[model samples]
Target: MAEVKQDQVPQTVGFLEVILTGPRMSGFAGPAWPRTCTIYVAIADEVVAWQTLPFESDSDDFKKWRLGIRVPVASNWPDLSLDIFVERADFLFRRRTNMVVVTREGPHTSGHTAVISRARLRLLDALVLGDMDDEEEEKTMKRRRSEVMEGNPRLLEGTVPFGKAVKLQDWELPAPGDEHGSPRAVVRGRVDVRMNLRPAAFFG
Candidate 1:
């Protein structure tokens, strides 16, 4: 096998964790549903990640999931985190990012959408944990996991890079038993893009 250099890739890769408020009837202003809603994170027509939210009556725990997003060099914009409804970032062709795929009468329908942006990455240092706190040796591995991302590009963001410039080894990473590559940043936000999810397309 050949070791591929991160620099030659045209897309940005990232791991995402989204905290959903609920299976609401509408937007954040909508009433929360007692059950769960299947959510997806996508770029262009590619559905990169998806999760069926779990409902809990015991606590106010919102749905959290970690997925990946790929941003091509074409749509590589610094302000990808801005709300999709904005005039500048506005997208009318089948709402993408942080969405719930469902069936509708026609290809056209009205809906609300929000994407989280400028989120802080939760730099995970195992030595920082209580179990691994006792280890005094040099940190072996390190990983960067995005926080609960909300808002809308479904608030999808990734490590900085433009055209094969992402070198994970050169990125900020250090910790034994920890692996790091192109650390990702995340936040708390929500998006509402309704569509249908066919598992065969993504899973196949």
Candidate 2:
């Protein structure tokens, strides 16, 4: 875990933790004959703040690997999180190719969507010691029509609702344990997000 301060925060943050589920890969696996996976979390976009939790292989605590990411409420959007399983490890070792697969066998394929519930946020704040003071948080502005139009040719070519509010849903994945008491399978959860939408822009 890395410490982040308000003023000198890096543009991007990374988290390395054991993949309790998903696929097997090099450099991250449990002690039991290589039955798990490893994952990395990388986040950008300063306007929206995000956080992720690495899954723990030995604990029965379901909340250990959950994440909480904050988006501007002015956008009329909910806070969100994502659960990812590292199903495969792509390795380039001395010109040889090796890959490891980690998966959960059941009705759910180790992946599901999620909405960042209030409970989830509280749990995340405690885990990461996140500071959410109004004064400290940063807000981002909406992109100019020119910029949006320039970048997305489709928008200019068609009658797209550039500022429409899109409803987001929640998802979840599967987490399975092995005989040796290690988490060998994982599930995922996610929320839909419409970036850069502001309340004032939509209303007045």
Candidate 3:
């Protein structure tokens, strides 16, 4: 193979990607589990993604169903938030949590009673380019003053925990409960994801 120059590598501007790297769900194979498994995550619009998983697992890893979503910026797109959640099973009840809301000003993971820190909001706003230059190409460097993340696309670089701790900018994500360490934890499993802009080497 011929050596490829840096300029030949591919890249993207105004991109939002989420990866379900390794999902370890805990449940019995009985009917108690949800009749269906659906990921109600809001991308450009309401997400209609559903998944069927084995209620019981013999191994510690349930990554058989991995996901990679890339949300692109379009002039006509209206929605500004990316909502993520799991549907409730018959035996399960609802729990209050913050909803990620985005707008021309900024993004925030907000709930009725509480709101996420401003620092965290900046992390999610990594790719929300309100006025991205339509003339610019993906491979070319961005020069717009409103460009998100000076250089990087502001994606969670490495395998980060998707549990209680939420830090997308920092790949580590402070896995205090690295192994389901939460004392009151009912669901016993781990989720490590790698959501990046993705280097061109990966496509190669």
Best by lDDT: 3
| Quality of model 3 by C-alpha lDDT | 0.36
Q: Which one wins by TM-score: 1 or 3?
A: 3
Best by TM-score: 3
Q: Write the per-residue lDDT of candidate 3 for residues 1-204, one digit (tens) a residue.
A: 999998865443334455654444333432222333343445544573444433444433342556667655333222355444444332223355443432321122232111111112122333333222244432232432224334443432321112122221211232565775433323323333333343333343
TM-score of every model? 0.24, 0.19, 0.36
Summarize candidate 2's per-residue lDDT along 18-94 as a digit string, tens digits.
12222111224321112222332222212222233233445443234433332223111122332322222222134
The TM-score of candidate 2 is 0.19
**Which parts of model 3 have CA positions greater than 4 angstroms off?**
1-13, 25-35, 59-61, 74-79, 89-190, 197-204
Better of 1 and 2 by lDDT: 1
Q: Decide which is better by lDDT, 2 or 3.
A: 3
Per-residue alpha-carbon lDDT of model 1 for 3-68, expressed as tens digits?
889876655333222222333222242233223234454433345555544334234544332233
Question: Whole-model Cα lDDT per candidate?
Answer: 0.28, 0.27, 0.36
Over 4 Å off in model 2, which ranges?
A: 1-37, 42-79, 95-204
Model 3 Cα shift for residue 15 (angstroms): 2.9
Compared with the true structure, model 3 gives a TM-score of 0.36
Q: Please give the RMSD to the true structure for each candidate, in Å.
A: 18.8, 18.3, 17.6
